[model samples]
Target chain A: MKITCSKSNLVKGVSIVSKAVPSKTTMPILECILIDATTDIIKLTANDMELGIMTEISGDIIDRGMIAIDAKIFSEIVRKLPDNEVTIETLDNLQTVITCEKAKFDIAGKPGDEFAYLPIIEKEDSIEISQFTLKEVIRQTIFSISDSESNKLMTGELFDISDNILKVVSLDGHRISIRKVPLKKSVADRKLVVPGKTLIEISKILSGEAENVVSISYTKNHIVFEFDNTIVVSRLIEGEYFRIDQMLSSDYETKVRINKKELLSCIDRATLLVKEGDKKPIIINIGDELMELKIKSQIGSMNEEIMITKEGKDLLIGFNPKFLIDALRVIDDEEVTIYLMNAKAPCFIKDDAESYVYLILPVNFNSAA
Target chain B: MKITCSKSNLVKGVSIVSKAVPSKTTMPILECILIDATTDIIKLTANDMELGIMTEISGDIIDRGMIAIDAKIFSEIVRKLPDNEVTIETLDNLQTVITCEKAKFDIAGKPGDEFAYLPIIEKEDSIEISQFTLKEVIRQTIFSISDSESNKLMTGELFDISDNILKVVSLDGHRISIRKVPLKKSVADRKLVVPGKTLIEISKILSGEAENVVSISYTKNHIVFEFDNTIVVSRLIEGEYFRIDQMLSSDYETKVRINKKELLSCIDRATLLVKEGDKKPIIINIGDELMELKIKSQIGSMNEEIMITKEGKDLLIGFNPKFLIDALRVIDDEEVTIYLMNAKAPCFIKDDAESYVYLILPVNFNSAA
Candidate 1:
C-alpha cells in the first residue's frame, strides 16, 4: 500500500487497530496489521479471531494497493516519527518503505489476502447509545465477571435490552453487579453475552464523550460496535448467563445510610489484620447511629466504628473486604444505603433511582469473635 | 513499650526501617521491627541480616521498654491511622495495642532480644559528603552494575576514597561507568564494595538536598550511612571489585560532539526495529558534520542521520542501544562528546570536566551493512 499521512493521524489509526493484534499467534499474519489503500480513504485492520478492529486513516492515497505489516514495529515507528508528513510505499516483493523527514524504515510485509476477514453485521436491527453511558455501565459491572477459564459463561457479561432501557449484569459465584441505562429511543428486546475481555478493550477505545454515540449491531454469533472512525467486531459466548434476577431481593431487616468514604476506609483499615492466603472476613455490626467493623486473624485483630443513619432492626454480617471495596470504589455518591436481611443472606447496595444494584453473599464465620 | 506520637511521625519512622524487613525469612524475628523505647527518643530498627536500618521517631516516651512487631502490619496500621496522636502500648504477654482516634488494634509481638542488632561503626573513620552529590553519583553508575548472582562482587559498586576525593565505579561484563565527587575534607583512605541493592535502598532514603550531609563509615564487614533522622547499616560485599581503571584508555580514532537529546532520540527510534531476543546492534557511521545510525534486523532496517561536529577520522561502529540510552538518560548535560577508537574497541562518552565517564564496548557484526 502507498499512502501519505500526518504523523499524528497515522499513529492514532495504528494504535486503535493494534489492540486487536494477537501478541503470540501460530499464524504469522495474525500478528500483522492489514493496510488497505485500495479505496479513497486508507484503512487499517487487525483480527485475533475472537476480536477484530478496523480504523480509517485520514490521508492522501497515492496508489491503490494493500499489504500487511507487523503491528508492533510499525506502530512504534509511527509514534516516534518527527511531527511531519509520513510517506509509506510498498514494492512488488511486498517490502514496505516508511519515510518521515530524515528517518526511513524498510520492513518486510505479507500480502493482505491471507488476513482473516472481519465478521459482517447486518445493520437493520442496530441500536444507538451514548458512548459515555455505555462505558460507565461496562466499568460498573465488568469487575465482577469471573476470570476463571473453566466457566466460560461467567467470563462474559449479560447485555439485556428492552424498550428504551439497557441492563448489564455480571456475576462470579461470590457476587453480582447490575447497571441500567436508558437509551435515546425504544428498540426491540434482545440479549447478548459479550466476553469481558472484549468489553474491556472496547471501553479503552471509546472516547467516553456524551456527544459520541455508539451504534451496536449483533447477529447470532457476532456483535459489532461502531463509534468514531473505528469498528470493532467480537464473537459472542454461546451460553446462558446466570439467572441473577432470582438471587436479588427487595426485602431487608436492616438498612443503613452511611458515608461511602467513611465505610470504605473503616473496612480497609480492618483488612490490615488479614494476611495473604488468609480466608478471614471483615465483620460489620449495624446498630442505631453506629456501625462497627471488625477483623480477627492469627496475627492480630482490628476494629473501627463509623457513625451512620440506621432504620429497621439491627444486624450483624461478615463479607470479603475486597468485594465491598470494589463496589464502593466505582460508586459516585456521597452517601449510600446498604440493605441487610440476616447474617446468612445476601446483602444489597442499591440506589433510590434503581440505576445500579450490587449484591454480595456474606461469609459464614465459625465464631463472631 | 509505650509512646505517643503523631500519625505522620510514626509512619515515617516505620517506613524507613521497614525497608530492611525480610519479606520471607525462616526466622520470624527477622520480619519484625524492633521498637526500642528505652531511650529518651523512640527508635525503630529492622534487620534482614544483610541490611539493617534504624530511625528515631519524634514522640513522647511514657515508659522505657522494648518489643518487636510485624513490620508489614505495623506500617499498614500506622499509615491508615487518623492524623492524630497515636498511642502504642505493649502488654505483659507481648501483645501490642495501638490506638488512634476511634480505631484500635491488638497485635502479637515478639521479644526484642531475639531481633538482630545493628552493626556499630566507629565515628573516627567516618567521612561526610553532601547527600545531593552522593545520590547523583550513585544514579549515574548503578545502572552498569552486573545483576548476575554468580559474580557477587560485580553486583556491587566500588567506593574509593583518597585525599578529599571519592571515586565510584561500576562494571558489568560489557561496560564500565565511573563517577567522581569531592569530599568536604580529607579523611582516611578506604575502599569498600556496597551491594547494588543496598545502594538502591539508600538512594531512595537520601534527601537529595545540598544542605543535607551524609556521614559514612565502614568496618571490616559493615558500612553505615547516617543522614537526617535515619541510619542504614549494610554488610559490605567480600572480594575485590573489577579493576576498571585499566580498561579505560585516553585514546580515540574518531570523536563526535552532539546534543545529548538528539542522539538519545535517534537511538531510541532505531531500537524500534529491534525485537526481543534479536541480537542485532545499532550501527553508527561517523563522518564530517553528519552521523548516521542504522539497525538491520530480520524483520526490518532503519536509519537516521543526526547533525554533529566531528574531529579526527571518520569511522563506523556498532553498540547496544540500551547501554547508550542508560548513560545518556542520567547525564545532566545539554551536549556531550563521544570518543570512538574502532569498530572492535570500546567507546567513551564523557564531558569536558571529566567528572563522569561511561565506556561501552562495541558489538562486532558479521557484516557492516
Candidate 2:
C-alpha cells in the first residue's frame, strides 16, 4: 500500500479516529488504526469493541492496499512532522515507511485482516439535530450520569424523542438532569439509551455552529452518529430506562426567582468548606426577600446571602452544593426560578419555557435537631 | 487582629508565601501562614523549616495582633471572594472571621507564637543583578542538576562569582552545563551551592523585565533573595563543588556549524522512538557537508539529515537525545558551533563570546561493531 497525503489532512483524520483507540486491551491489533486505501479516498478506522470511529481523508492512492499501524506511535510521529506532504508506503513484509521532507520512519505494521471491524447498523430510522444543541444538551445532562456500572441503565442516558421534541435525561440515584430540545426535521419516534462515555466523546467532536447538524440513526443494538466526514458507532445498552417523568415534580408550596450568576457564585464559595468525599450540605434559609446559604464543614464554615423574589410560604432546605453548581453553570439565563415542596422533598429548578429541568434531592440537616 | 485590604493585594501576598508551605509535615503549624498585623504594614509569612517566604501587604491594621491560619483553606477562600475590600478579624477564641460583600467565613486559627520563624542571616554583603539575567542563567543550566539525593553536591548548582564574572555549573553523571554572566557590580568574592528547588521557585517569581533587579545575599548557612516587597530565605547546601575546569578541553579534531532550530527539531523527532526506561542513543554520522541522525528502538527506527558546515575529518558518535535537546532548547542562538575530539571523546558546544558552554559525553554505539 502506498499513499501520499498532506500533513494537515492526515493529522485531522488521525485525531478524530484516535479517540476510539482502546487504551488497554488483550489483543494488540485493537490498539491500531487501520488505513484502507483500496479506493481513491483514504479511510482510517479504529474500533474498541464498544465504540468505533471512522473518517475519510483526501489523499492520492498510488497503489490500493490496507495496513494497521500502531495508533500511539503514528499519532506522535504525525504531530511532530513538518507541515508538508507525507508519503506512506507498505512493503510485503508489513514494514511500513512514512516519509515527510527529510525525516523517514520505518515501523512494522500488522495485517489489516486480523483487526476487528465495526458492527454494521441498519440506518432505517434517523433524526436530525443541530450540533450546538446536541453539545449543549450533553454538557447539561452528562454530569449527572452515574459512574457505576452495576445498574447499567444509570450509566447511560435516555434519548427519547416523541412528537418532534427530544428530551435527554441522566440520573445518578441522588439527582436527575433533564434537557429538552426541538428537532429540526420530523422523523420516526425512537428511544435509546446511549453510554455516557460515547456521548462525551461525541460532544468533543462537535462544533458550536448552530447551522451544522448531526444525523443520528438508531437500531436495535447499535446507534450511529454521522457528521462532517466521520461516523461513530456505539453499542446501545439493552435495558429498561428509568421512568424520569414520575420522578419530576412541579407542585410547590414556595417558589423563588433568583439571579443565576449570584446564586452560582454563592454556592460555589460555600463549596470551599466541603472537602472531597465529604457529605456536607448547604442549608438555605428563605425569608421575606433574602435567602441565606450556610455550610459548616470540618475545615471551616461559610455563610452568604442573596436577594430573591419569594412567593407563597418561606421554607428552609438543604442540598448538595455540587449538584446545584452543576445545574446552575449550564443554565444560560439571567434569572432562574426554584420550586420547593418541603424540607424533605426534592427541589426543582426549571426554566419558564420548559426547555430545561433540574431536580436535586434534599440532604438532612442536623442544625435544627 | 483586624485588617481591611483589597482582594488583589491579599491574593498576591498569599500566593507568594504559600509556595513555602509544607505539603506534608509532622508539625501542622508548618502548613499555616502567620499573619502579623502589629504595625501599619501587614506581613504574611510561611516557613517550612527548609525554606521561608515573607511579604508585606498594604492594609489598614485597626489593632495590633497576630494569628496563624491554615494555608490551604485561606488561599481558596481568598481566591473565590468578591472583588471588593475584605475585612479580617480575630475573635477572642481564635476563631477568625473574614467578610467580603455579603459572604463571611469563620475559620479556626492557631497562635502565631507557636509557628517557626525564618533563620536570620547576616546581610552585610550583597550583589545586584537583573532578575531576567538570573532567571536566564538558571534556565540554561538547571536541567543538568541531578534529581537523586545520594550525591548531595550534584543536586545543587555551583554559583561561583569572582572578577566581575559569574559562572554557574551543574552536572549529573552523564553531562555538564556551564553558563557565564557579567555582574554589574562586584562585591566580596563568594562561592555557594544553592539548592535546585530554591532556584526553581525563585525563577517562577522573577519577572521577565530585565530592568527589574534583584539583590542576592549569601551567608555561611543561608541564602536570601529580596525583591519588590518579598523576601525568600533558603538553607544552602554545604559541600565542595566539582572541579569542572579540569574536565574542559579546547583541542578538537572535528568541528561543525549547524542551524540551531534544525538540529533541535531533528533530534526531537528522533526521540519519538525512545520510550520511558529505554536506553536508546541517537547515532550521529558526521560527513563533509551533512549530518545524519539515526536511532532504532523496540518500536521502530528513525533517520533524519540536516545540512551543516563541517571541518576536519569525519567522525561517528552516539549520545542520549534528551541531553542534546535540553541544551539546544535553552540556547537563544540562530546557529551553534560544535567541537569534537574523537569518536569516543566528549563534544563541546560553545558560543562565540564564551558566555555558554555545553559538554556532552558520548555513548558507545554498537551499530559500528
Candidate 3:
C-alpha cells in the first residue's frame, strides 16, 4: 500500500480507530489496524470482536493495496511525526516505510486479509438525533449501569422507543435513572439493550454539537452508530431488561422544591466525615420550609440545613450520599422537585413532564450506622 | 482554641504544612496538622520525624489555645468550605467545630502538646538567593538523581559552595550532571548532600519568582529553607560525595557544534521504536558535515540524519537513548558543543565557561544487540 497524507489527518484517524484495538488478546492479529488504500478513500479499521471502529481519512493514494500494522506502534509514530506531508509505502517482504521530512521508519506489516472487519448492519431501521441530545442521554443514565460481570442484564441500559418518545433506563438494584427525549419524527417501536461500556466510549467520541447528527440503528444482536465519516458497531447485551414501569408513579405523600446547588453542596460537606467503605448514611429530616441533613461517623459528625418549599406531610429518610451526588451532578437545573412516598419506599427526583426520572432507595440508618 | 480566617488563606497554609505528613506511618499523630493560636499569628505545623514544615497564617484569634487535627480531613474541609470567613473553634472534650456560612462540621482533635514541632535551625550559617534561582537549579539536576535505594550516595545530590560559585552535582553509576551559578558575594566553603525526595518537595513549594528571596541555612545534621512565612527543615544524607572532577576532561579527538533542538528531536523520534525495559542503543555516525542516527530492534529499524558543523576526526559511538534524553531535555541553550575522545570513551556536553556539564558513558553496541 502507498499513500501520502498530512500529519494531523493521519494522527486523528489513528487515534479514532485505536480505541477499538484489543488491549489483551491471544490472537495478535486483533491488535492490528487494517489500512486499506484500495478503496476510493483511505480507510482505517480496528475490531476486538465485541466492538469495532472504522474511519475514512482523505489522502492521496499513489497505489491501490492494503496492509495491517500494530495499532499502538503506528499510532505513536504518527503522533510524533514532523508537521509536514508524510509518505507511507510497502517494500519487499511486507516491510512498510513511513517517512516525513528527514525522519524515516521501517516496520513489518501483515496482509489485510488476516484482520477481522466490522459486521454489516442494515440501516433501514434507524433514527436520527442531534449528537448533543444523545450525549446528554448517555451521560445521565450510563452512571447507574451495574458493572457486575455475573449479572448480564444489569450491565446494559434498556433503549425503548414508542409514541414519539424515546426512553433510556438504567438500574443497579440500588437506584434507577431514566431519561426521555421527544423525537422529531415517529418511527417503528423497538427495544434493545446496549452494553454500558460501549455507550461510555461512544459518548467520549461524540462531538456533542447541535449541528452534528448521528444515525442509530439496531439488528437482532448488533447496534451501529454513524456520524462524521466514522462508524461504530458493538454487540448488544442479549437478555431481557428489568421491568420498571410499575415501580414509577406520580403518587407521593411529600413533595419538596429545593435549590439544586444548595442541596448538593450541603450533602457534599456532610460526606466529608464519612470514610470510604463505610455505609454511614446521611439522615434527612424534612419539615415546613426546612430540610436538615446530618451524618455521624467514627471520625466526627456534620449537620447542615437548606430552606425549601414543601407541600403535604413531613418525612424523614436516610440515603447514601454518593447516589444523591451522582444524580444531582448530571442535572442541569436551577431547582429540582422531589417526591417521596415514605422512608421505606423509593424517593423520586423527576419533572412533571416526565422528561427525567431518578429513583433512589433509602438506606436503613439504624443498621448502616 | 478559636480562630477566623479566609478559606483561601487557610487552604494554602494547610497545604504547605501537609506535605510533611507521612503518607504511611506507624505513629498516627504524625498524620495530624497542629494549629496553635496562642501566638500573635496562628501557626500550622506537621512533622514526620525526618522532615518538618511550619507556616504562619493570618487570622483573628478569639482565644489562646492549640489543637491537632487530621491533615487529610482538615484540608478537604477547608477546600470545600463556602467562599466566606471560616471559623474553627475547639469546645470542651477536644471537639472542634468548623463553620462557614450555613455548613458546620464537628471533628475530634488532640491536644497540641502531643504533636512534634520543627527543630530550631540557627541562622548564623546562611546565604540568601532568589527563589527563582533555587527552583531552576533543582529542575535542571533533579532528574539525574538515582531512584534506586541500593546506593545511598547516588540517591542524593551534592550541594557545594566555594569562592563565588554554587555548584550542584548529581550522578548515577553511568552518568554525571553538574550545574553552576555565580553568587553576588562569597561565603564560607561548605558541602552538603540533600535527599532527592526532599528537593522534590521543596521545589514544588518554592514560588519561582525573582522578587521573592529564600534564606538557606545548614546545621550539623539539618538543612533549613525559610521564605514567605514558611520554614522547611530536613535531615541531610550522611556520607562523602563521589570525586567526579578527575573524570571530567576537555581533550577530545572530535568536536561537533549541533542545533540542540534538532538533535533532541531526532533522538526522541528514534525512541518510539524502543520498548520499556529493552536495552536498546542508538548508534551515531559523525562525518564531515552530517550526523546519522540509527537503531535496529526485533520489530524494525529506523535511520535519520541531521546537518551539523564538525571539527576533527570522524567518529562512531552508541548510547542508551534515555540518558542522552534526560540531559538534553534540561538544557536551555540553542546550540550545544560535544567533545568525544573515541568509541569507548565518555561523551561531554559542556560550555566553555564551565557553567554546565553533562557526561554520558557509551554502550557497547555489539554486546547490546
* Top TM-score model: 2
Q: List fnat per candidate, in order.
A: 0.86, 0.88, 0.88
Clashing pairs for predicted structure model 1, backbone only: none
Off by over 4 Å in 1: A367-369, B239-242, B367-369
| Cα distance off (Å), candidate 1, residue B25 | 3.6
Model 2 C-alpha lDDT versus the unseen true structure? 0.91
Residue-level lDDT tens digits of model 3 in B1-369: 899999999999998998899999998888999999988889999999888999999989999899999999999989988889999999989999999987899999998999988887765577778999999888989888999989888899998888867899999988999999787776888888988888888888898898899888898789999999999999889988998989899899999999999899889989999998898999999999999999988777888899999999999899999998998988899999999999999999988897889999999998644
Q: At residue B103, what lDDT does model 2 achieve?
A: 99
Give lDDT tens digits, candidate 1, residues B145-199.
Answer: 9999999999999998877778899999888888888887778888899999899
DockQ of every candidate structure: 0.68, 0.88, 0.76
lDDT (Cα, tens digit) per residue for candidate 1, span A1-369: 689999999989998998899888999999999998888989999999999999998999888899999898888889998889999999999999999988999999999998897877765467888999889989999999999989998999999887778889999999999998887777889889999989999998899998999999888898899999999999999987777778988999899999998888878888777776788999888889999988998878988899999999998889999899999988999999999999999989999987999999999876755
Q: Model 3 segments beyond 4 Å from truth?
A: none
Q: Interface root mean square deviation of every model, in Å? A: 1.5, 0.6, 1.5
2 versus 3: better lDDT goes to? 2
C-alpha positional error of residue A251 in candidate 1 after TM-score superposition, expressed in Å: 1.6
What digit string (tens of lDDT, one per residue) describes model 2 on residues A1-369?
999999999999999999899899999998999999977789999999999999999989999999999999999999889889999999999999999999999999999989898887878788888889889999989999999989999999999988898989999999999998887688778889999989998898887578998999988998999999999999998988988888887799999999999999999999999999998999999988999999998888999999999998899889989999999999999999999999999989998777989999999987622
- Report the TM-score for the A-chain of model 1: 0.97
**In candidate 2, which residue pairs get closer than 3 Å at backbone N, Cα or C atoms, i.e. clash?**
none
Sort the predicted structures by lDDT, highest score first: 2, 3, 1
